[model samples]
Target: MTATRTSSLRIAVAQLNPVVGDIAGNLAKARAARKEAAGQGADLVLFTELFIAGYPPEDLILKPAFVKACEEAVDALVADTADGGPAIAIGTPLKRSSGLHNGLVVADAGERLAERFKIDLPNYGEFDEKRVFQAGPEIQGPVGVRGVRIGFPICEDIWGDLGICETLAESGAEILLVPNGSPYYRGKVDIRQQVVVRQVVESGLPILYANQLGGQDELVFDGASFALQADRSLAFQAPQFEEGLFLTVWERNGEEWRCVEAPVGAIPQAEEADYSACMLGLRDYVDKNGFRDVVLGLSGGIDSAICAALAVDALGADRVRTLMMPYRYTSKDSLRDAEDCARALGIRHDTVAIAEPVEGFTEALSRLFAGTETGVTEENLQSRARGTILMAVSNKFGSMVVTTGNKSEMSVGYATLYGDMNGGFNPIKDLYKMQVYALSRWRNAHLPKGALGPLGEVIPRNIIDKAPSAELRPDQTDQDSLPPYPVLDDILECLVEGEMGVDEIVARGHDRELVHRIEHLLYIAEYKRRQAAPGVKITRKNFGRDRRYPITNRFRDRS
Candidate 1:
């Protein structure tokens, strides 16, 4: 009997963030990734979905020049691969006879092998794929690589009860490789795991999943690339909140391919993951757009404190400045806490007491409002005063003002427009108030990536443990204007992201009146959110740009 030897294939997955419409730049990234894979003696290099043109180009993909430029870049990349190391598989848009397809083209050296188009175009919740892409009938077979058959499925193909994997398996594909440009949202990783496991169970083949990571305007992609073996075990894992590239080996055992288990790295906790994503998104937005520093008003509240810590961590201590704009109602404790936090972080701090401006504004408005007593009008005036000071500093010093309203406040009409709401960027606008506290504690416990300030206690402990207040009026507390954060955050999670109606949320054991009030507030805040600045998103549904609701609509939660 002659001894038989089976060949093994090593595939490298590149987790990268590419700028949209940057054709030449994306091609250079692909070339560099291929070179890295080749250096490791891997047989093939794989990139995320739409790697050539970047994901979700929206209307830009409809342009003829942009698509033509992408095609030319692909051609140049093919020419360069002639001297090659590893074969390449990358995603791009394909303009066909029927329509434009979100497609992937595979190549060996300089020759094109096979092309596959995504069959499922998701149009729900932050995805508008159906608006731009024409789906292709599933390609069942595999492309030959190193004399082996590998299956390809564009994102959304393996997501559900789709038979793409089964079809490929029946067509004699030994392994499945999925390329995705999935966006970030809370609990999305679990969703990915469930979908990938379904494909693995169906095809009985090991699968490699790669995803893009970065902030594209209002969206952020969390790169937690993973691999699953036929036995439903997670074989290899990549870190979240950053770009990475790694190789995994698959071995053949009898009929199916099995992933040789690589060490699984620890994934960040929910709070930590959310914090890092916010910091990275804000950092990139500032750096890429040529803003060097950030300035924010610190109210000794959870929102501004967390934003300050994140800004310092993202852009260094020298680039961050905190201003304590105290008024007559401003608590002494708040001033002391703000000073402590600034001193702890080693960032620039100043006290520009707003009492002078507050008095002047009240004196000016007294005659016009002679008949009316004070209410939210007076509260809003104080906020406007602080907003003016922050805006002036932003103008004169050229520092971007970082707003610090969390998602809870943003969802309701709790935030004052043209007041505390004015800023160039907000790091925590997507997080709930409860989440803000959790992340603040997490940062205090562990050092965040790219942190340049001192390691211990950046946020004052008193601030984290104290009640949140705007201090716009005497003895003001957030609880006075809205429900407690514990109840408010839960209601928001259901009403906004879950899309649950009043009765449905009430079924969750909350007071019906409170639920009704929250629903009304959420609906009314659409107008304010429309004018709000973009923020880092950590949830499935964030206000502004991503979730568009009508301000004049009369939909009510009758239940």
Candidate 2:
């Protein structure tokens, strides 16, 4: 007679986006997700790591009372799960006899089923996990769930080649479930899929991976949670760059478990993902912090135009406003393009000509400077005037000002500090200049997430086609100061992100002198980046708290 398998489990992955330090609010979101999963006949609801307290609580996990409160919240959640429909596997930091362990508390019917701690602690890049929490020793046996043994690995444990999954498989574990609070940068989604598929193949057990989705300060989490079969095929995918919940069905085979077919949600492209990440981060930062709307200077350049479209998409037309601060050097095409982009987004727009203030500033500085040649100093004055006008509008109308400088500009001190950089938040500071142009074209062609403005050509095609300029001086195109965007972005990636030396960059067939100039500018601009507004990070080495190069360091390696 053939052996038969009878048991099946329905698991719901809650791709929840939680705010830092908001325990009560996070708990509320978790409970609501659990309830929804239960209503859909799910046996278990799996949430991302530290769902109770939020991911990478950093030093907050070192506070004893905060950890205790999180444990209490976990207990309360366990009690809430006793409603008899669905069990919950949730991550939280726990204070134990040994030390503080990054852990997950599993509950079924008001009783604790298992407590799994994270074994591997990542200590590089944006993570300082090894600093605060103690690593878990090792699991002796698999967690028993519904008469079937299951393995539960916390976030970083399943990332590597060796660890819990192999041990659990050797000890009769039938399935694996992993939870994560992974932050978003470019190329992270592919890395996540590779790791999950590796675990499934290694353990010969189907895997369920859940991840958090939201913006917390400098970091943004993209929710592209997925499930994989024992054969390493993708079973289902949750939505990316949003909060969602979906159920995945798993059935028992001879001794292993396998997943059934489920609909995979839409997967956005690189440009779309970057755009949505910015919009989501901006929307959350503004709305969660209690700002009702945003205001910004609408230059005809691609950066501000794309930023305006993002603002309108994130907060709707009523919540976004634009002011064009035209100086004597401002061009007619610029005026037309700014108005066209704002009008296309259905946002309130007005021109506040700064000719008087420009004249006044020039007069004031003329007496002070006396004999200094009129150069970048005078050009920056115009930018400062526009910044002042935008800030004044923000102060009067209670709207936050959104700065619109891209990463390329921010990298090379090309942006004037306290001038065009004045704002409460920046939407595209992490995006490169070429990326800004691409996203501008993409937005003109497609409707962005939660877009409330008119559909077609919100950003005029001319804006996309125009030569990029600051218009601070007569005929001052970006190319006059920096190299073309494609070349500049490549050199910047090599220097800033790759940490490539001068020779390595020169090896890429770039002009050696130009590369050196970019490097100097990047290092010199550290001071300005320190003062810029917080924006979503879409690259490996964003110029925020993530990359910390000193402004006064003199250790240039020219060899």
Candidate 3:
């Protein structure tokens, strides 16, 4: 019989972080994962979608040399299987006579068993696979690996209406193994489980889902890989926002297979998941880019304080630093608070007086200003001076600047570009002002599993209690210029995430005039958000690829 039967089979899930464009490094990671699986005596090791090419290769997939390099890496791995240890099921970009395809290859020993392409090329939001990849065949059969026939679907294949999973089941595939590069947003784990459960119920087969782990630019792939039985029961679940290697043992029960041995645990909460995504995103951005350390302005405000804490948690305290660029308007409370927060986190804190720089700029511009009254122009000079100082520090010490603006501020142009907005990355860029405060409280109450920072209140109580301020002028608070953060965040969410009209937002008990004004601000601030540093996306709609708006867009809801 051509079909194989097995009472038991073992498979390993390789949940790892891969840097885009790092072909050789990714190959090494694959090799190490395969070795680990072999040590565990597994039948096959499964990697995430586009593992060799490092997922979402974007325009890099358009390059022939890059695709060829990834193909060569897969060949090398196949050669390694010549010893007949365990099979390798990996994702890579495969070039065909028709076009390039997001391909998955299954190999055992020295022989290639199967090759399948993603039937659905996701072309919306964060995915643009259709821009580079061609769809797979209408019907795909399973490959027999160690007496078990497993059907593999790349990311987005099962999520669509292609009926690929059901097709595989009809083709006699006993189970499904899905490779995904799915990124994180709030409550994404539950969504994934629901999607997989539907597929399982439809196909009458179990599924093993392996998602990529780590930060790729603005996207953070939380590795909460897991398996589900045909009965809609969770077989096992991997941790989120982490790199893990998990082995699963499956046993044939009559006509179906079930995961007999694996991990089963609860995933992290939304708050923990958001915080972890930010930390992981910042860490990968800094390390993958080869930065020695990170530095951020600690203004004694909740935004900067939380960003500083996230930095310490991501990279140890010794690698993180903070600076306070104080001017005349800078209050003594801010001074003390910045110092206190730094001490609490045990990071380097320095003071750079921006008075002189501001004075010099004022002197140079006085003649040009002539009779112009001192106003926002002068206020912005203070911010610009501090920004210059931060960049200088970054240049001299080789530290990446951490921008500390929250989404609430970014939405309404509350942040100053090239000033407080100056940084290589922002950990909380996707978080709103209210969300930032919530995470601050959450961080103080809990030390994450692998956090490098100390336990207890990393952010001082005074910092969280005090009103937020940029201190560009005397007695300044965020509320003086814009609506309350709770009000602002809600309005922005309705506009940005919910895509609600002004009348719809006003119906949410907001002042009609205020909603219109905030809507206008959100549209006008597009230019600043366009230039903002890339940050981890925890929300469904981030400022970057997730939400694209024209900087010069003119449409606004006048109602």
Candidate 4:
């Protein structure tokens, strides 16, 4: 990195949203961003990890044709550099003699300037790159473009203890550029910054971190891209859960690169971040998967009401549809609350009574169980009837069904299988019952940026204040089958995320017998969770990705 007094670099960071397996679409997006960057007189443009093929292509990466398509797309983009515009640096999958690898290539003016492979492959949690792609063999040196030496580190390279960033700096790299597909969980932005800060201190070089924004399956990436000066000062921040092409100017000041111009984008945090994540996840899941709209059974309960609000905020009122599947047990208060919420959000609302279906099923089975008493099975029929009605609406109109079960109920098998759990996707699957109420209140008081839903109490006050229930039976409440939500949520947090023993959980003021019961339920519910629909992950350990438990095991937290 030869330094001069008058050298300045104009870099454009593309915080984009890419659909997995859409090589042609991703390439078109890259070309468009490059064109816009050229208009801004950018010397170079940087994109997030696997930008050409989208992030975490999962088992799709194993296909030979898929890998070839990704490589072809990268080559096409590299050839586009011959247009005499800004240089391009993007991530894609590369097949080599060593094996397939997550690779980054830099191009300038019709020439492939530099190529690098990911040094570390993450295997834990939702990442299973090691199962398919080969880890990078060695740490290569930086590439020189426009007389500046820039190093590339793909996602999980700098996060691990491989020292790839430090090695690049030692090899005369002046700037560090890291592209990532980091997903959203609570407090993830802070954790990412701390990781980069440590790397910056060790490498003694400025870093420009570019992360993509989009939802793939259950995971949603928050693109709060940021940069830091060599002196450890924040250069700029891109807004979270947003897509933008931002430019930053860096000058060679004596020996080190320093940022001169950049936009500091607003960063969403905590509950707002979580709410926006669910909304974005729903929007992308519905749009990318080719769904025209979404429908969910709104029972005037907190969970269904909040899901309705999030669906409206994501896809607008015109695209969101709500249904109230009523039975004999359905209360008038619930009827009023659900209607009020739909009215406030200005969405299409409809009602479908399930009494005939419930009665028909009962009569068909009455001969086989003439002496059987009415209990949980009979109540579950109500739920199943409701589920079937919502799915029918979806099938008839091509709209996806959004299930509204929270994490607390899902933890203890509180949901009925093929009943309330039947849906194309879930919006609040990771949020606890308490957190669901909190977000409901937050949405009423504050309308998040870019939300299509109306502001000022889109969710009614009565909905937030009401006790949650399934209404499968007369005077039925969630607490009748399980503990209070506040107590259950705390116990669940300890057992699921903390992996705490029953004895330890009991010590936190919970009853010893109750802790034991909740633990057993959590383990037994693994089967139901296995079949549950995917949703946005808000906690440290969501059901499907972050935490994977065995369904046939008998090992218990007997402690």
Candidate 2: list runs displaced more than 4 Å. 1-6
**lDDT score at residue 287, model 3, on the 0-100 scale:** 96
TM-score of structure candidate 3: 0.99
**How many steric overlaps does candidate 1 have?**
0
- Per-residue alpha-carbon lDDT of candidate 4 for residues 232-310, written as tens digits (9 for 90 to 100): 8899899999998999999998878999999996688778999999999999999999999999988899999999999
Residues 1-559 of candidate 2 have per-residue lDDT tens digits of 0123347888899998887778889899989999899889998898899989988799999888898889888899999977897888999998887679999888887889888888888877778899999988766457776666778887788886556798899898888888998888877888998988788777888888888998887788988998888888888888888788888888877776778756587778788888888888888889878898999888887888988999988889999999888887889999998988887888888989998987899998788899789888888888888888888888898999999999999999888887899999898988889898888888888886766666788888888888888888888788998899999999999988899999989999999989988988888889999999999888887886578888897676577
Of 2 and 4, the candidate ahead on lDDT is 4
Q: What ranges in model 4 sit over 4 Å off?
A: 1-6
lDDT of 1: 0.85
Error of 2 at 96 (Å): 1.4
Ranking by lDDT: 4, 3, 2, 1
Per-model root-mean-square deviation over C-alphas: 2.9, 2.6, 1.0, 1.3
Query: How do all models score by TM-score?
Result: 0.94, 0.96, 0.99, 0.98
- Candidate 1 per-residue lDDT, tens place, 1-559, comes to 0124346778898899888877888898998888888888877888999888988798988888887888788777767667767788889988878678898888876877778888888887778888888888556588887777889988888985668898999898888899998888777888999999989888888889998988777778888899999898899898887686788888888887887845467777787778888888888778756787999998877788889999988889899999999888889999899888888888899989888887898899889999998898988888999999999999998899999898999899898999999999888989998889999998888887656656878888999988888887778788987988999999989988888878888888899988888888888888998888889878888886567899997787875
For model 4, what is the alpha-carbon lDDT of residue 439? 95
- Kindly report which residue pairs in candidate 3 clash with one another: none
Candidates' lDDT values, in order?
0.85, 0.86, 0.91, 0.91
